[model samples]
Target: MLRYGILFLSILFASSFDVSAAAISAIQSDLAVLRLCNASSPVSLQAVNSVLINRDMKSSETQTQDFKCFLLCLYVEYGWMDREGGFSLHHIKLTLESSKLPEYRIKKLIYSCTATEITDPCERAFNFTECFWSHSDKETSPEAEIPEKEVSDNQNGFYYIN
Candidate 1:
C-alpha cells in the first residue's frame, strides 16, 4: 500500500509539472509571434490608431479584445514587443527579472510612447494611455514563476489567440 501511494504521488507530481510547462510554452510562443510582428513593423501610436480604426477595435471585453490592437501598436512603436520572444534562456531571464506590468497598462504604454500625433486631447480614445510614460514604475511582468522543467517540457512552435 505504501509503495502504491508513493507511485501515485510521483505520478501526480509529474502531471502537475507537465501542465505548468505546457502553459509556459504557450505563453512563450505567443510572445514570439508578437515579437515577430513588432520586428516586421515598428509600431507607433498612429499606426495602432490606424489599425484600430480600420478594424474598429475597442477596449471592451476587459481589453482582451484589444490585445491584437496592442500588439500592432507595440510593433509600430518599439519595433518589437519582447526582445525576440525568449530567443535565449538569458533573454527569458532578463524579461522575467524586469518589473512586472499589468498586461493592459503595458498595452497603453505602447500607445503613449509611440503616439505620433496627439492633436485631440479632448477626444483621447483611452485614458490609460497616460500610464506609458506617466511614471517610471514597473509592475511585475506577466510571466509568473513556474518550474523551469515545466516551462521547457511544454515548448510550443506557435502561439495561439483566443
Candidate 2:
C-alpha cells in the first residue's frame, strides 16, 4: 500500500509538472512572437509592461489610443494584417488554431474589430485597434486562457496535441 501510494504521488507530480512546463512554453512563445513583431519599431518590453501596470486606472483617450495602436502595429508587423489595409483571416485562424484557442472567439474578434472601409494601412490599423480595445473582454483574451493542447515537436515540425 505504501509503495503504491508513492508511485501514484510521483505520477501526479509528473503530470502537474508537464502542465506547468507547457504553460511556461506557451508564454515564452507568445513573448517571442511579440518581440518579433516589435523588432522594427523596437518598443521595449518595459514600456509595454508599464502600460499594463495599472489596468484599473482611468486613462485618457489618447493613452488608450496609444496602447491600441501599439497592439495593432504588432499585428501588422506579424503579417497578420496586410499593408494594403486588409486582415489575413487565414493567418489569424492558423495562429489561433495552433494555440488551441477557440475559432469562434477569433471570428468574433475579427467581426467586431475590422474596419471594412479603411484603405490606408496606418488608418486601418488605428481603427481596427480602437475597435478591438473597445470590444475587448477578459474571457476572450488569448492570454487569459490556458491552451487545451500541448505543443510538441515531431519529425515535421511543431504540433499541438491533447
Candidate 3:
C-alpha cells in the first residue's frame, strides 16, 4: 500500500506539471501579443494588468472610451480581427490556435462568439474578447491556468511568468 501511494502521487505530480507548463506557454504567447499592442501609445499598466489578470474590465474601465479602444487594439494586434469588426475563422483556427483546445471546439467558438450586433468597433471587439476569453477558459481545466506573477518596477515595464 505504501509503494502504491508513492507511485500514484508521483504520477499525479507529473501530469500536473505538464498541464502547468502548457498554461505557462499560453500566457507567454499572450504577453507577446500584448507587448505589441501596447507599443503604439501605451495602454496604462493598470488597464493592461486588469484585463490580463481579471479577464474583464471594471465597469468604469469599460465605460471609458480609451479603454474600450485599447481592447480593440489588442484584437487587431492578434490578427484574427478584421476591418468589419468580426473575427476571421481561418486566423482563429489556423493562425492563433489556442493551446489545449481541439479544432472542432475552436470552430464552434468562432461561430458562437463572432461579433454581430454591436455597432461600435470598440464595443464589438471588447464584447467578442470577453466572450472568447471566457469560452477559452471554460474549455481548459481551471488549474491549468497560472496567474500572472507579480513584479515591481523595472525599466522594461514587462512582467514575466517566472
Quote each prediction's TM-score.
0.20, 0.46, 0.55
The alpha-carbon lDDT assigned to residue 151 of candidate 1 equals: 23
Pairs with backbone N, CA or C atoms under 3 Å apart (clashes), candidate 2: none
lDDT of 2 at 51: 41
Residue-wise lDDT of candidate 3 within 86-106, one digit each (tens)? 554456667546465765556
Residue-by-residue lDDT tens digits, candidate 1, 1-162:
323333454457656775576766664554455455444543433344443334333424213424444443443233232222211223323443365755444443443343333322211222223333243255544454422121221143211111
What global local distance difference test value does model 3 have? 0.58
Q: Mark the regions of model 2 whose C-alpha exceeds 4 Å error after superposition.
A: 1-19, 44-73, 77-79, 93-108, 138-162
Sort order, TM-score high to low: 3, 2, 1
**Clash count list over all predictions:** 14, 0, 0
Model 3 is weakest, by summed lDDT over 10 consecutive residues, at 153-162
* Model 2 TM: 0.46
List per-prediction Cα lDDT, in the order shown. 0.37, 0.53, 0.58
Q: Between which residue pairs do clashes occur in model 3?
A: none
Kindly report which residue stretches of model 1 are placed more than 4 angstroms away from their true locations once superposed. 1-19, 44-162
lDDT of 2 by residue, 71-92 (tens): 5666765656754556765566
